[model samples]
Target: MAEPFHIGFLLFPNLTQLDFTGPLQVLARLPGAKLHLVAKTKGPVETDCGPFLLADTDFNDCPKLDMLCVPGGFGIDQAMQDADTIAFVKRQAEGARYVTSVCTGAFILGAAGLLKGKRATTHWAWHSHLARVGAEPVKARVVRDGNLFTGGGVTAGIDFALTITAEIAGESVARAIQLGIEYDPAPPFDSGAPDRAQPETLEICERRYAGRVADFEAALAAALG
Candidate 1:
């Protein structure tokens, strides 16, 4: 039998727990696949909600992976500004067969110089910022530009994983995983994306995250220096 495909998930402090966990659950159910939660250090990492998650391995100890997944949250802005994290991401992505990001994880990838001239996506609120980092921003739920796949906001990670599984393992496997997860989704509100949202709603979201956005811009500028 062939050896199982190895997948590494980059974990950092303040990461969106669901962004990583949701896809980890789906991928773990697949046959003959190994998953590793990798962090800068092998210890418990805290999420934005204050919960702690134990990582399986440190970056130095992580084995070569067939796929690398980066999940995002407010913490990503910090990670993007981190020189050590950016260097690690660039190195790992260069070695991994496929590199992917969830939500604002694209910011980290962009910081690593992985998204240059590549089409990518991120949370709707941060799409323009993505373009500023030299990535051609696409407003899709999942944008697969070659070996680099990126998704929109938090929930889009699930869809991105399914799409990638279909490409890698096959449509049957993807469909089975989707079914196993009971993937049907119905939002009470119709405004999932900025284009679909009411002007007032978009305005509110922009205002709410304005300070965060400002901080992110400052961080990106510093990281790029």
Candidate 2:
């Protein structure tokens, strides 16, 4: 029998729900996978979209995981500066076979000094911030530098999880899972990315993230120092 594979997602207040749940829907199907939603405490973690997710284990009680995934949102503006969160992530990465993040969660890993000198990526608006933490940011949905993996933005986590599934279990297993989930993305609009978006669409996106980008940069600066 295959050994049990423990997968963990770091839960925090104000995370983008899609970043955590999108990947959850896919990675949960990995054969022999046991999922752990971990946080500073076994309490309610809120999402940016006004929903709440419960973390099953606190950092102290969580089992050693085979994989650890951090999900991003505006909450990351605060999470990146949290010492306990950074320490827990740093500690978990030391033993996990795969260390990964979705969207701006990469900055939390950056806070732990995990991304130093690594090729990584994050949400397009914040891609430049990667270099502040010593990461060479790439412009792609999924990027892997050794054992570290990063997803571009919220919805990109689904693709990121599938890629990791292919790496660990193989193409066949990943394909089966993708098929089972009917993971076909056919959005009615072609504005998912910055380059493809109409100028007005890009403007709205920029406006939405304008304040957040500023706050996150300040947090990132404080966290790194």
Q: Find the 10 residues in a row with the least total lDDT in model 2.
A: 216-225
Backbone atom clashes (below 3 Å) for every candidate: 0, 0
Residue 42, candidate 1: C-alpha displacement in angstroms: 1.0
The residue-by-residue lDDT of candidate 2 on 84-187, one tens digit each, is 89889988999999999999999999999999999999999999889988899899999999999999999999999999999999999999999999999999
lDDT of each: 0.89, 0.94
- For candidate 1, write residues 45-79 as lDDT tens digits: 99988889999898789888888899998898788
Q: Which stretches of candidate 2 lie over 4 Å from their true place?
A: none
Residue pairs of candidate 2 with colliding backbone atoms: none
TM-scores of the models, in the given order?
A: 0.96, 0.98
